[model samples]
Target: MRFGYFLSCEEYSPAELIEQAVAAEKAGFDGIWISDHFHPWNDEQGESPFVWGMIGALSQACSLPVTTAVTCPTTRVHPAIVAQAAATAAVQLQGKFVLGVGTGEALNEHVLGDAWPSEDIRLEMLEEAVELMRRLWSGEVVTVRGEHYDLDTARIYTLPDEPVPVYVSAFGPKALEVAARIGDGFINTSDDADTVREFKEKSGGKPCQGGVKVAWADSKDEGIDHAHRLWANSGLPGELSQVLPSPKHFEQAAQLVTRESTAESIVAGNDLDAHVEQMRSYVDAGYDEVYVANMGPHYLAMIEAYGRDVLPQLRG
Candidate 1:
């Protein structure tokens, strides 16, 4: 399995993100995955730069292939606009871009003041959006009058030689079905063997990508502290993440997430063995590629250490 770095737009400034990308390339990461968010998960995480602009900057900064770990093109942004932006990014990256999309969460999408739809409705919108974006990428003028969206005489002028691959992010059966039908690939955040196997089986062997978050600091305690403070929401149960409407709501819910839970859930500190084990779970689970994100201030050290110790062992 290939290993890549995940740049968290929700956590880092644009300059820090670009620096990390460059460092990741130097550290021998295979590619890059970037989060697309309008708001940080909570105020503590502290930044959310426009992902499209960052993609453009990354294209100019490094040769690493980049995938938006997931973007929601169905709501805050129109699929037509996503199509144009993705096409331009692919061209800038010389066709090394993958548009990873999803049904989206209220945290980011509700900003436009639109009512958050149910999961089924959101899935339908995603299906329609994906279809419309694909049509737009063909470089032909297109018109559509669909249930969720409409297009009139719209055509993408700046196109990549090949259509941008749309990887669908799914966490459940219904979403998986839509992913198999529409996605060029599959994306998920956990090291879930059953889900990965099911997606591949249903999709006829398309690539499956997964992502994990870790905190690296001087000691396990320090790492746990960072993870708890910044990403405790990651431990929330059910659809709470999908339904929480703002950073404040997320913060309110995350208060229920204790440091012990964060410690148990997140790989922490400079224990190379622990880090390797977490990543290997994704590999063993049948992911084609896995992206890793650092959750604290020691990101530079984390990347360098991965290059020096963790990556070599994994490759071996």
Candidate 2:
């Protein structure tokens, strides 16, 4: 399976992220996935760099392809804008960029103060949004009036050698179906084989990528503490995924996930078997590729260990 790094675009400056991208490429990572958030999921995690600008800069500095962990075109930003931005990035990258998108998070979408739509509405909006983007990319005068959007004399003429691939980031059945039917590929991070299986069955034979975060340290306790401090909320079983109105709301929900919770959420320790088991779950579930995120201050060590200590054994 292919491996890549997942960057939060928080807790790191643009220069730092670009450096990380370079490091990841040097480490033989296949791709890079960057998060798109107006704010960190929580205040504890400060900094959310402008997503497009960062991607553009990284494209110039890194050899590996980059994808937005997930951008939503339906509400927070118009799909047409996303298409145009992606088109520009595609040309700049010489075709090393793919637009990874999702229905969206309240953390980002609530900025407009529009009532958060239900899952069905969000899915419906996604369909219309992607359709709009695809239409706009043709460089044709697309005068489309849909339930969610209306475009007139819309066209994108500066497309690169080809259309940028669109990958859907999905979490459930209905969203999974949408990803399968429309997306060029699928992106997820459930670490649950069953979730991937359900997604693939609907994803129309599209390629799939999953991101798994691992904290590597000389001691397991240190690793666990690091994971807890940074990503404990990921353990909330869909915390703020639907309920939070904004990053502020997410911050509130995340406060519940303490170090004890982190121990439960993540696969702790340097146990080769545990890591392998985590990786196996994704592979067995039909993920075409897996991106592993090394979460900790000692990211360099994590990468070294993966290469020098973990890879040979996994391959063997």
Candidate 3:
């Protein structure tokens, strides 16, 4: 499986993200996955830069292929706007960009005062958005009056030689079905073999990608501490992540998440064996690519370690 580095916009500044992307390339990572968020999951994570701008800067900084871990085109931003931005990014990256999209969460999508839609409605919106984007990417004047969006006589002037690939993110059956129907590829955050197999079967063997977070520090305890402090929300159960409307609510909910749970859920510290095993899980589950994100302040160290020790082991 191909290995990539995940750039967390929630935790690092734009400059730090650029530095990490450069480090990741030098570290022998194959590509990059950048999160698109309007706010940090909580205040402790601290930063969220405009993802499009970061993609622009990234194109100049590194030759690595880049994918937005997922962007929501149905809300906060219109599909037309997302398509234009993505096309521009594709051109900037010389067609090495993939637009990974999802129905999105209330945390980022509701900031425009738009009421968050239910799962079914959100899925419907995503389908329509994908259709709109693909049409726009055709480099032809497109006019559409659709269920979730309306487009006037619009055309993307700046275009890549090939259309940007759209990878759909899904964590449930309904979303998975939608993804299989519309996406060029599939994306998930977990290494669930059944889900990956199901998508591949339905999508005629489309590529699947997975992402995992690890906290790399000098010791296991330090890593756990950092993971708990910054990403405890990751442990919250069920639909809490999708429904919670703000960082404050996430912080309130994350209060119930324990450091032990964070340690259990996230691979922590300098255990190269554990890191390799975690990544291998995705491969074993049938993922074509896996991206790893480092939590806390020691990301540079983590990147270097992965290059020198972990990645070589995974390859072997």
Candidate 4:
């Protein structure tokens, strides 16, 4: 299985993100996965750089393949615009970019004042958005009047010779089925073997990608504190993440998530065995690729530790 670093655009500045990319490649990561969001999930997380701009920088600064851990093309931006952006990124990366997309979260999409649609409607919109993007990527002028989006003779002027592969992110059975039917690959956050098995079964064996969050620090307590302070929102159950409307609301909801909960959700510590076990769960789950986002300040150290003590074991 291939391994990658998950660049949390919500948590780091643009320059810091670039530095991490360079460090990740040097540390033997196979690629990088970047989260694309207009706003951080909680104010404590502190930043959300425009992913396209950061991606352009990464293209020049590093040689690793890049994928949006998942971008929402269904709402915050028009699929046509996302098509153009993905096309440019693919060319910029010399065909090494994957456009990972999802139906979207209310935190990002609700800012435009568009009422967040139910999950069913969001899935429908996502399907149509992917179709429109594929059509545009084919270098054909596309005009569509679909239920959720419309295109008016839109043609992408610049594209890689091979179309950028679209990886659809799913957390539910319905969305997983949709991903299977329409996507070039699949992306999910769960490391559960059942979940990964189900995705592969439904997707007819397309590449399955998983992402996890950890807090790597000199001590377990320090790691726990970092995770509790920054990622407590992650412990909110199920659909809460998708439906929470803003960072403030998320922070409010996260108040219910205890420090212990944060530690449970985020594997935090310096124990090499603990770190390896967290990743091994994904590898054992049948994920073709697993990307990790180190949640604390010791990012470079985490990368070094992974390179020296983690990835070699994984590869072996």
* lDDT leader: 1
Put the candidates in lDDT order, highest first: 1, 3, 4, 2
- What C-alpha lDDT values do all the predictions have? 0.96, 0.79, 0.95, 0.92
TM-scores of all models? 0.99, 0.92, 0.99, 0.98
Per-residue lDDT of candidate 2, residues 17-39 (tens digit): 78778887776777888888877
Task: Tell me the lDDT of model 3 at 64.
Answer: 100
lDDT of 3: 0.95
Looking at model 2, the pairs that clash are 180-203
Name the better of 3 and 4 by TM-score.
Answer: 3
lDDT of 4 by residue, 254-283 (tens): 999999877767778889989899899999
What stretches of model 2 exceed 4 Å from their correct place?
268-273
Error of 4 at 201 (Å): 1.5
Clash pairs (backbone) in predicted model 1 = none
Q: After superposition, how far is residue 165 of candidate 3 from its true place, in Å?
A: 0.5
- Model 1 C-alpha RMSD to native: 0.5
Better of 1 and 4 by lDDT: 1
Q: List, in order, the clash count of every candidate structure.
A: 0, 1, 0, 0
